[model samples]
Target chain A: MNTSDAFHRYTKKVCGQIRWKKAHDIVSREIENHLHDQRDAYMAQGDTESVAEEKALLQMGDAVSVGMALDQTHRPSPQWAMIGLVMLLSGIGAIIQFCYYDNALAAAPAGNISIARFAFALPLGILLFAAAYFLDFSFIGKYPYLLPVALLGIDIVAQLIGVDFNGKNWLSIGRFAISPISLSLPFPLAFCGLLYHFRHKRNGYLLGGLFAAFFCVQLVCFHTMSGLFVFVCAAGSLMLFAAVRGCFPGNTKRLFLLFVVAGIVLFAMFLWANSYYAYRMNTLFAVFRPETDPQNVGYFPLLLRNIMEHSVFWGKGNPLEIADYSAILYSGNFRADFLLTFLSYEYGWGIAMFLVLLLTGFLAFGLHKAFRQKSILGQMVSLSILCTFAGEVFVYILNNLGYPLIAPIALPFLSYGTTALLLHMALAGILLSTFRTGEVFRDKELLTFLKPPLFQWDNGKLIISFKG
Target chain B: MTMDKTLLAGSTAMLILKLLDGQDMYGYQMIAELAKRSDDTFHLKAGTLYPLLHGLEKKKLLESYEKQTDSARIRKYYRLTPKGKKHLHEKTEEWEVFSHAIHQVLKGGLCCEHI
Candidate 1:
């Protein structure tokens, strides 16, 4: 039986009262079905078709009232606890700069510019975060190709004409040099969009792998092993998750095994091909034997180890009577790379442990929220964001503890880099956005209907049907 | 005999939960079952039922899934979650205590005819 015009008008009116567009389709469909069932029942009781529909419409009660109720329940609520944690972390980062590094920064000519730049970057980073938080993240899926292509194009342009900063190409953005390599930070998000786009196609995983290779190459070309490591971990996990979730078009287990094997082989090849990476690995192993080479590669680690060894748990460690105190303070990128060491040396190891635990707890909470999402896209996006943040913290802590496996990536909100600060803020925005709208974002392409089982017993068969 | 709308309104969520405790049910089916079980005393509006159901779902107290009925009509069915079941048990206990108190106060060992 066809639904009458009156039924359509009623549902439309009800949907109009719902402020959230995402909830409209679901609410409309459920209401439509309820109306149909009522109309059918009335018609069975000898009512005319028109009369039944009219009665059904009337019995549903006021459309506006129902819509208003649904609107109240359907609206996306911000994750206040997560937001508070983010703000707290960002504040700690700012405090680290102004309190510990301020005098050191003021003493140098470029430090004045750095401090001014940090002052400029803080609120600007918060604004970028706000913008990202309020943004409709569904646009990532809608224009899957455009985002990656644009980011890659920017990187290419930056490489060709950008200023060289510390042996890496950086786009000069008016007194602020932005690392084009950091542009790869959102590759996991872009990759998710591409996965959604190619969900129905054959060898889509291959395309995803190829896309990852391209970004990984960009990170490699820039010699940012930390960025490369982070991108691979975040984006690689996203791909693996998409496959496990059956968002791709092949045998899931086979694809999973293939990914694992490919990852191992490529990683081996990468390590073998790069002598610098090999040296970094060798240095990582040398961490335990820092005393053996105390004057060369182990100089800083040994210095750090000695300070930590002497440092008390709660208060200031023994007075700094070292002859090379200036050398320790003026180490390369001391504010960003060795801030944790300085923090521990001055304030005590307790604070350092607390900071690490706080960061770990925050990331764990984020991952938990991400896993609870009903939408695969939200899960993938959240995983990437959390992975990047967690990976940075892990590397920072490891390097701080005298392990120096790779150069220290910024410790997310606590580090003193404008670019990194801005990136963290923006990523926080995306993470908050995912948590805010996580439930309502159903990837339409991924809504697969499973065929019910057909049973046969003694030549009698029961066939189950599924319709899209 | 129809109950007061206010009384029915207060108990609608509990009644719905009780009805679904036995089996998963669609919106229309729940409404019909409520009326039948209440001997036509309950007349739940579709408008009220859906919003209530959705609110419960948002709280993770209920979960909904779509499946085709035997009659070839696609129906969205609601199932009570573990949380919802726990809630129902608590509500039932609270209701029993309140109703028993009301009964004792109203009777007071005196017949209505004497009054």
Candidate 2:
């Protein structure tokens, strides 16, 4: 078959495979409309019926290429990256808190794991998916502004009544320990809404400012080194967005002066925020001095050694085996070793290398798309996701290699946590949205749709019907 | 044309409500009727029409049913709920007031320019 005929067949096959009903219909109609136009052109040129049909198919191009182009429309956005980063970081933070701070073996805190399981992970996952599907709907989209406000208001009211549900504190309601942060899953969702609004509005600068403000607020609330690291990563991602968009303020001198002033202010705030900074600084120093607090500082090193000695290549079936081996080998406490130790013990070096290559590929592809897309919204969204992952992967590696400054951040898709899962899904959704809206796909579809009679409305209505 | 575009988009819910107000019609019939009424000025694209229809259905403004047509093809037909009529009435009033104000402004501007 000719390339065009092959392309047409590919398009039909791929369009049939699209899972989302709306997306599938949109793509199928577009392809059919293009094919119809080609047929009409061939007929107008005085070709015989069969010859016109064959020529039309040939001119329309390859189906797989067209299908691939159409498929890009559903790729996720930078918000997904930000979500993944936060979720992974938060999951790692929770794990760290549990292993080191919470005394996990001490009676298990009277319904802690159950609350973590049912309240946090399960409900949050469901809520994230629901929000993703409903984001574009009018009723859902129109009043989504109220969601974050309502969540924040409810959290405040609950707090006033001495009820805590954020998983920070355990509250017993009959048989269960209910956490409110379970409901706060929608806050990140609010960020997604905000991102979409700003993206459509073409307000990249505002998006960056909002991201910075949100990161600062998170840092203040968490008051941990990991939180600050995430904040920095978020800021860096936003800056990358700004730089990509060329939306930086025009007055370079003034902007520089403003940055200098801001830097000074931040430095002063850092000094004022001594407790948090001091804790981070101490931890950083402790990385070098493994004996400083062996339970905390030397824990990962001992665990890594045990994993290496016992089974350097696929050490154990259970990830927790590293902890068991460390306790026995170094007479150290059983804390969750950082992700690197978990990797070495559980999967082996091959898996780790594979994961690195996969992550590198994802980041490279994401960055390439970001740089190529002209739309500031698309570019910023893509870049933000790439930077967030880059920062996350870097920090995770640093933490594992005896730099033990911050808690481990989960690798996207691989780590277990409601926050991570939701975040990845959100990022994927955003990228998909961007890919759908990209200029190349837009132009091709626009050309097909703009043909005479197609663009002509029948008294303010579209002429075609998919059902027919 | 602009007025029609606004009316069509703004009154999409109203159009669906009005169409369903009388009797049930599948998406194809609804589009054909919409085109015929508008004198072929607004031909509804399936992409645009279906989403709006589905959105309205989801909001319970319209109810849909699947039945075998005479041609033996299963067709989904939509009919207006009472809630949809109420919504349409509210939207119609809003649109009338909005369009009247717009018309007055444009007419006044033309008269002033003539003077």
Candidate 3:
């Protein structure tokens, strides 16, 4: 056999039997054709048949290497990951529907299940199914960057239908009965995907334009302090990533122009959309004199007092529960507070600090790997996610201390919401993808923790090392 | 003249475009043409050639289709698009202007003596 044929045989042995016929067939055919060509070339060079074949095989390198390279090319794309996400979300939606509406529906007159409940669950369930189905077909893989835009469309439709027909809050679908925030999980997932895509592709103009449009739409549609905060944080994080990654084009003048335009538009939209910003501004300015607005600003003091009075250094069972209860008792906002109450109340001070350290350490590790490994995209995504996390932490801390006017964004991994789940999952996906790139921490030495100890005592003497 | 290997490698697209200006060819044929045109001076490595061809194909600058030769061997044939031709022409003109300017500066007034 010629070099190509030898290489093909080697590769087949290395890769084992590929289960997917289409992929396996294509790879096998390519190998066969390549070997044939190499054989012909060797023969034309006037070598004996055996010698030519041996020489051809020598030129093909190790079979395993060729098979690995081909496998890399044929590796399934993010389509599978997307499908998994959609299925997970659908499962979550089904569970939520069954839990909240099942008993209520059974008790109600037949066909009179609350419009609010149905409105909240149906669009969300449909959205999850549609996203999953679309992902399975690989429709969104080509334009992964556009996934967020599609999600935003779903959120808009869900919000419009929920509010107009069901008379429910955009976030909490019914009267504290059922929430559609789970449906909004796709938005954050899509956002993470977009960030990943843009990091690799660096289409700054498109990203900038999309952010601007999203900000404008959020301003018009919701006009809530929470909405404005989400828009600002999301847009700002993307822009920051773009800047750090050197994806944003244009030197000083152009950069200045873009920022100015963004600032002006954001300021104008904030002004037009809601008056709550004024309250937030006033509360921020009067942080020390929180008692002036006791019901709003004083909520934090009351919660802190409750925590301090109720338990010791570690405080309650879960900082999250304490925070939730405190919010309900003091601020009358039973909605889960992302940072302040959850961290301090549920995990308590010590555990919360430990959790924070662990999270920060993981993020730092991801960032170090991303940058050290020369993955600009990974670095950008890590940095952007880090910024979001930082902002969430900051807002939560401020809200806990005294700035209750600031809207809560659920703490990372601590809050139980669709957005939080999607965000964490996306973060996991990004880190995994970065790992797969083989840019970071590939050396066995870096994973020394997983290995057995370097030395072991045996019969009163120390054995230096263990053999592999 | 000694060739800058890095420069030649970097300008492989230009070299490929220049070669394809004369004829359409399959990957192996193009590789052979490159070697022949350069008087056996250059051989495109498989690792580099496949990725470059794939990239070009992705960018729509080149289109490929399979055809059976007289020997009944199926070969993938690649040809430049109208857009590719225009891009090649523009890049060629730019490269010529750039090289001429560099040559003039490097020669330090000996350029006119050669002319």
Candidate 4:
């Protein structure tokens, strides 16, 4: 057999026995190249072609032994450390959710809905995580149109039958309740797929990105202002990514002008749309003009500032019990609005900082791994998801850090909303699966850890040591 | 000689890390360099070296990337990571202490012999 043929037979014998079959191609290619190089070196020694091939093959030692050693090297091992960290963060948040809602369940006629939803949402989120982890994350990219199609479908349905909740329409499914606007959570992945598909065609890139942004705005305008803000921030990050890769239209200088002009137009149109959005602007304006709408629009901001005035390094934590019912209830019902104020007023800033650090760690590592991916599809999806994570965390913290609460973003690990919990967990699972798939890159490393070294010992005396 | 085939197993990873400490090289280059430096006393077959190089990469002690040469062939290069360099330094110190002990024993120069 030719050198190439012999190398293939050897690789098949070894890699075929390994369970992580995805790694066979890389291993086979690498080993074949090695064998060919060796055979050439032998030919330089003036050996005949067949003899050189034979000697080169022989130098590799036993075929079965080498295959087995390689097979031991390429096994798939899950990263439990990161998974554990995510679980711990989520668990702490769930505990706090339970404590607050459980205590308030007796006093409030709403029957502690926040705590109940958070508790039920945790397991569902985990189930989503498990499913996403096992299933290939690239499935989102497989049908690149899936996320956008799904988003448009949800938006249409919500418009048709969505019910009003706290001035915004929320879609309910039979007995189950869900906010249609929150469905925008997965929009980034779909948007990334669009960008990935049109990464070459500059026109398609611009059109697809703008179309994706418009759809996100459509979903947000009908439901929540915060959704629109989050979506815009995420889209901007993706644009920056595309610009850096030279995928954006014309140059980045033009793109910056487009952003400013678009911002002004959107701001003008947003205020003119409805009294609901106008009222939100008034709330923002109330931040500076405190006397503008005292006892109404400006009330919560005043309450937040008062709460911040008594800041401690470590938070008091979620109140043991809602001692001052009027504290949260009477001042424009700031239960959800001032979540940070409540958190700092109860838990301490330390918990908030810790939660943010944990999430930042997860997102940072996930992005780092994804960027390392050689495939553009992988990088796009990873960047999209990471951008979403960063956007949510940043916006939420900004709103809390003495800024007018323009939006109430659900913290990754600490928030109590079912929609937010489920969405975060699902995205998290996708990131984890991507990281797991990265194992195929280190097939050589996996084999090393999969099997222990062979050591011969007689009464604890070292006789032979085989590393692989 | 046949029995000593397994002798390279335990130290193969360590040796590979040492070679990759400052310089980056691929599988074939590593084998040829190791053989050349050891004066042909060590023969690291293609099979043995590839697996060991890959294993070190998996452990994250070494990282690999491919470079394109003028010959139009892509050669995969390996380098020591910070973790790997620290490991190599520790192992070098360990090997010295271990070999020094072995040398003392072989020369019948153990202090315990006087006792």
Candidate 5:
């Protein structure tokens, strides 16, 4: 073989052993550079070019053996620890549901359906998680609007033919009913991609803002205020983050101020127009001082306070004996919204604290790893998921503690509902999928063209210059 | 003089990490530096060194970056990561204990009286 082509031939052979094709170019380049350096060093010691090349080629050893060694280390790295944690959380959810059914079923036989539903949902959620975990999440970046648009389309259809439960619309097929609110949870993740796709374009924020507004209007139309709140909070934070990171065209601080003022004024007007919402806001305030509305809106808060106060640290606490009120406390709603309080009441504050700590630990671990990722798409998508979990857990804790600031959102994996469970598992899968391929996957579309360095040093004097 | 393959293989990663503990170096530079520092007792081949460096990087013990040298040649330099430094520290301690034991055994004297 010719001397120059010999090095190329060696690199090709070495890279052929590496099964992951993406790593081939990188491995090839490094090996080829080393060969060239070796050749140059030999030539510097007075060998002819051809002799130097021969010596350098011999120094690299067997191509196949080197490649085999490299192949072992260059394989795809899956986050097994994170995967175990996710499954652990899912298992905890099942145990909590089992506890609820075992305790409350004799009192309310209707609780049997929930147990049956849980059986069905758990497998389906796992199946979806598996699917999402293997899924290349970059498609969200490729088609940024696909998830949000599909969700909106589903919601629209649900509004037309879906079943209504307590005035909120849910898409139902057979025994499984998919809450539109749960469907809306992925909006922020999709928005991350949407923002990324338009980050470099002029007037991209305008298009992005309209897309968010459309989703908000749909949620408001369906009267899913909790979903609307989540969608806005998560999407708003993403937009603000993008703006601050110079993803948007305008001044980030000014745009953020404008959005805050606009949101407050609109929210106030809505409250002024809607007395029911206004009353709910007042009830939020009156929760701490339950004596003001003891017979009415403050009733639940007072009961919650009484239950928490009476609960012990480790074992079962004294059950409230207010007749029908206690019966209501043992219903399915208690399993979904007041899970922490229910657990505290039945088990103890210790178990509740354990659950809280476990959830916090998982979220903190995810946030730390996600933030460490260099890819922008991975960071943005993970931020959205982490924010959703943090927001839900925060709201759930407040509502359970008797504040009732907003309608209680499910505590992610811990809450009891088929669609909610399925959605959360799917989201978790996406998160794990991101962590799995984060190091290798790059969103070429989102990558900005780096300008040449504008600052340089000449003769040890620092020079700064501007670039056009 | 050739060292035992297994012995060389076991210590190759430790030697490479120790070299990088001083400063970042390209593949060829590491090979040359190892020979010089070990007084020609260690002669790491390009094949062995590159794979070992890549393996260390995969474990996050090392990180690589490219920089243009004075000759305008872009060289891929590998440096010890914080994790790698900690790993090297542990390996160094283990090696000292192991070599000391071997020395005592070879001399027919137990410097460490426990065994």
Candidate 6:
């Protein structure tokens, strides 16, 4: 047989069985290169091309066994602990939804219509998560433009003529009332993968920043007010990711310019548009002086404070009923925002604090895991996802605690929105696929970090130990 | 002495880690170096080496970065991380104990009549 044929057979046997098909190309190249080197060495020792090739192929040993070994080595290992934690939170979310639904039906007469958005969320989340976890995430980078282009097209069209909900902020699809926000959620993720993949090329970051800025502009003009904050944070993260990776050589100026432009536009739009967005800023007053606006926007902050103060270490009280989603929903009550409040009331402060720790630990471990990725694109996407997650969680918790710099960006798995929950699970799946090859955290640091130190000696041993 | 194929495959990771503790090396460089250093005994194959290298990286025992040569070929170089260095030390210690025991058995020091 020809050298090419032998080489092809060798690689096919080696990489064909691997689940992460994206790694196959690199695996084949490395093997082919090795074979060529061995063949060249034999040729130097007075062997003909075909003879050298045969000898080289012979030295590789059995193709089937080698392939199997490789398959075993590169097989993806799911981070089950992290997956379990996310599932636990989602379980609590489901229970919360059930509880709210029960109470809402009891409060209403009888014929109130229940929103089925969350009914499909769990099943859809499972499907999307499984698909993302099983498939190679590198495909996102491979066909990057497909998702971003489609989303932009949809968003632009939605902005132009799509049916509006509640004074032109949210765009809903025909008949089924599918929110355009849900459709646009996956674009940032795919865009970051492409950016990381193309960071080395000329005009890469500039072009990426330009597209991103244009997208941000579209989001701004489209007035996806609730989604606009998430878009800003996600897009900002991608830019920061590019800057840190330094993938775009000498294009920092253009990126910075785009950031400033988008920043100004988003800030101005927030000020000009949504009153609820404006109401969130009044949260600082609620924290410091609760009596200032006792009747208005100060109610949530003061209510949260009261809940914390009256709350036991383990909650013995009933779950707090906050947002009356019944007016909007046809049937069940919408507990859309108030995640932390619900956690404290239902599971108690103990479980709530424990979950807070879990969230922090999970994201920290994810960020650490991303650095260990051998693939630059994996690292980039991982960082982008982690940053977006971190930003949302931080803002969400802070907003709950009375420093509401951002509006109610819902908690990841615990939030009530169908689209938010589905997107969250899918992001987790992508994160899993990225860190599938790497250790989630190193050297038992998580346990140590979570555990209170045995020693409290401030003389020399124990410094500041952080509580979750 | 000839070794079992499974045994050779098993030792490749430790052998690669052992080689890498001294210096960083790329794929082809590693193959050549291992052959040269082992006097062609271990005979590390390239097909197995890349996957093994990648596995080690995933375990956080190694880190890699790419550099371009004057000839413009991108070369991926692997080095022992701090975690990897600590792991290598432990592996070396284990190997020393295991090999010493094996040597004792081979040198007619152990009684295997029961077996």
Which is the leading candidate under lDDT? 5
Candidate 2: tens digits of C-alpha lDDT, residues A158-232: 445533333243334443433332232233334433443443234444553455455345444433344455545
Candidate 2, residue A358: Cα displacement in angstroms equals 3.0
TM-score of each: 0.87, 0.47, 0.49, 0.79, 0.79, 0.76
lDDT of 3 by residue, A47-82 (tens): 866786665555544555555554444443333543
Better of 5 and 6 by DockQ: 5
Report clash pairs, candidate 5: none
- Residue B18 in model 4: shift from native, Å? 2.7
Candidate 3 vs candidate 4: which has greater DockQ?
4
Highest-TM-score candidate = 1
Using TM-score as the measure, name the better of candidate 1 and candidate 5. Answer: 1
- B1-93 per-residue lDDT for model 6 (tens digits): 886779666567788998898799887788889889979776776657776888898688988765545533445688999999898888889
How big is the positional error of residue A109 in model 4, measured in Å on the Cα after superposition? Answer: 18
For candidate 5, the docking band is acceptable
Q: Which segments of candidate 4 are over 4 A away from where they belong?
A: A1-3, A44-52, A100-120, A164-169, A200-208, A242-281, A288-293, A311-333, A347-354, A364-379, A441-468, B1-3, B68-74, B104-115
Clash pairs for candidate 6? A113-A330, A113-A331, A114-A331, A315-A348
> For each model, chain A TM-score?
0.87, 0.55, 0.56, 0.77, 0.81, 0.75
Q: Is candidate 2 or candidate 3 better by lDDT?
A: 3
iRMSD of prediction 2: 12.5
Q: How displaced is residue A291 in candidate 5, in Å?
A: 2.6
lDDT of 4 by residue, A207-282 (tens): 7546654755674566566666666666667767776766655766666765675566566645654457777678
DockQ of 1: 0.53
Worst 10 residues of 1 chain A by lDDT: A450-459
**Rank by lDDT (best first):** 5, 1, 4, 6, 3, 2
User: Which residue pairs show backbone clashes in model 1?
Assistant: none
Give residue A410's error in model 5 in angstroms. 1.2
Please give, for residues A227-298, the per-residue lDDT of candidate 1 as tens digits: 777777787788778787887776867697659765875586467547677667657657878887777777
